[model samples]
Target: MKAAGFGYHRPETMAELLTLLADLPDARIIAGGQSLMPMMNFRVAMPQHLVDIEKIDGLDSINLRDGTLQIGAMVRQADALASPVIKKNCPVLADAIAYIGHQQTRNRGTVGGSLCHLDPASEIPLVCALLDAQLYIASRRGTRMMNFRDFADAPLTTSLAEDEILTRIDLPICDPDTRHGFGEYARRSGDFAVVAVATHLRFAGETITEARMAFAGLGAIQARADRLEMFATSQKLSPALIDKLAQEAAQMPAESDLHHDADYKRHLAACLLREVLERILRHG
Candidate 1:
């Protein structure tokens, strides 16, 4: 099926993009067009206009400023994966991007598009939630920052207003003591995960001072298992403790889709959680 008829506009400046968005409130903003194009091809989305933001200057750069990693909304997944600042400051994010589609798709998929699409199986949303990343949005009213948990509302839905555009992603730089790990289960390479988990730990000597765990493919939105995260901290890292937390994490709500049953997803969650935790403990 062909995409429904729509006017296409490529804006080279942020001001132009904002004007286009505000004037055409129903227009869809295209970054990499990775997710939107497919949806359009499937006739799932029929926007009257496509305001392409890729031509906008400075939206594709990755920079670190004032101890925060600022990623432009139009930054490609491949570029982000290869960013030295990202690799050093947030290895887990790099690892997560490595699992997104393949090299070609990663080269064209923008981080802002992925987060805005809000697919439950997407790695970016889960990582964003795990790291407490802030999304910067622009609208006629002005710019505003929203946390990942609040920005993403459900699969294929976000809190972004019709005239708003996602401009950047702000991630706090990881401290020296921070340890990160990521894991995912997919039927094939480059396919969306049946379940994905991202975890971070801050340790003082041998004790875990802080910890966070977020899971995708479990609910209407990517979610952090705060209950299990709190339990894992302060406890000595051991196979036994890892197994216990994994088991507890399995109790979290999981969505059942055509590909897998609820029980299987729950089992995968426990297994992957343990795997990630063990790896972090060994390396930390």
Candidate 2:
């Protein structure tokens, strides 16, 4: 299938881009176009106008400041995956990005594109959720920031207004002692995950001081394993405790799709969570 006819406008300045957005009806922002192009080709999206921001400056850099990692929304996945700032400050994010489609896709995919696409099983949003990242949005009105959890509304949807553009993503740095782990199950090397787990833990001697656990491919949006985190915090992990956490993961909300059933996904989640937890214990 081919995309329906549409007008394309490339704007070199944000002010110009915003004006186009305000003036054009049924306009869509095009960055990376890794996800949107396919949707348009399949006729799932037929926007009357496409505002390309690729020529705009200052939306592709990676920086670290004041204990936060700031990434421009237009930062290419490949650039991000190889960025020293990202690798040094947030290595777990790099680990997750390694699971994204492939070298070719990563070369063209943008951080903002992945976040806006918000695929249920995409690795990018899952990491953002686990890190409690902040999303900065801009428009002619002004700029506003929101938590990543709030930015995500549902599968393939976000809280972004039609006229608003995502500008940057801010992620807080974890404590020096934190140990991170990530695991996922996909049908093939480059396919989307069926179940993915991400976790980080800080231990004081032998007991956990801080812990975070989140899952993707379990429901409409990525979800944090709150019950498990609560249960594990301030407690030393034992065989019994690990077993209990796995059981709790099995009970998380899961939705069935054509390829996998709810029960199967739940089982995968339990296994993957246990594997990641065990890896952290053994290595850290």
Record all residue pairs in model 2 with backbone atoms less than 3 Å apart, i.e. clashing.
none
- Misplaced by over 4 Å in model 2 are none
> lDDT of each prediction vs. the true structure?
0.89, 0.91
lDDT of 2 by residue, 67-119 (tens): 99999999999999998888888888989999999999999999989999999
TM per model? 0.97, 0.97
Weakest lDDT window of 10 consecutive positions for candidate 2:
172-181
For residues 1-284, write the lDDT of model 1, one tens digit per residue: 78999999998878888888889857998888888889999999999999988778888889989999999988999999999989998788899999999988889999888999889999998889998999999987899999988898778889998989888999988888888889999999999999999998888887888888999888878888989988978977788889889889878888799989888898999999899888877876
Report residue 38 deviation for candidate 2 (angstroms): 0.7
Model 1 steric clash total: 0
Off by over 4 Å in 1: none
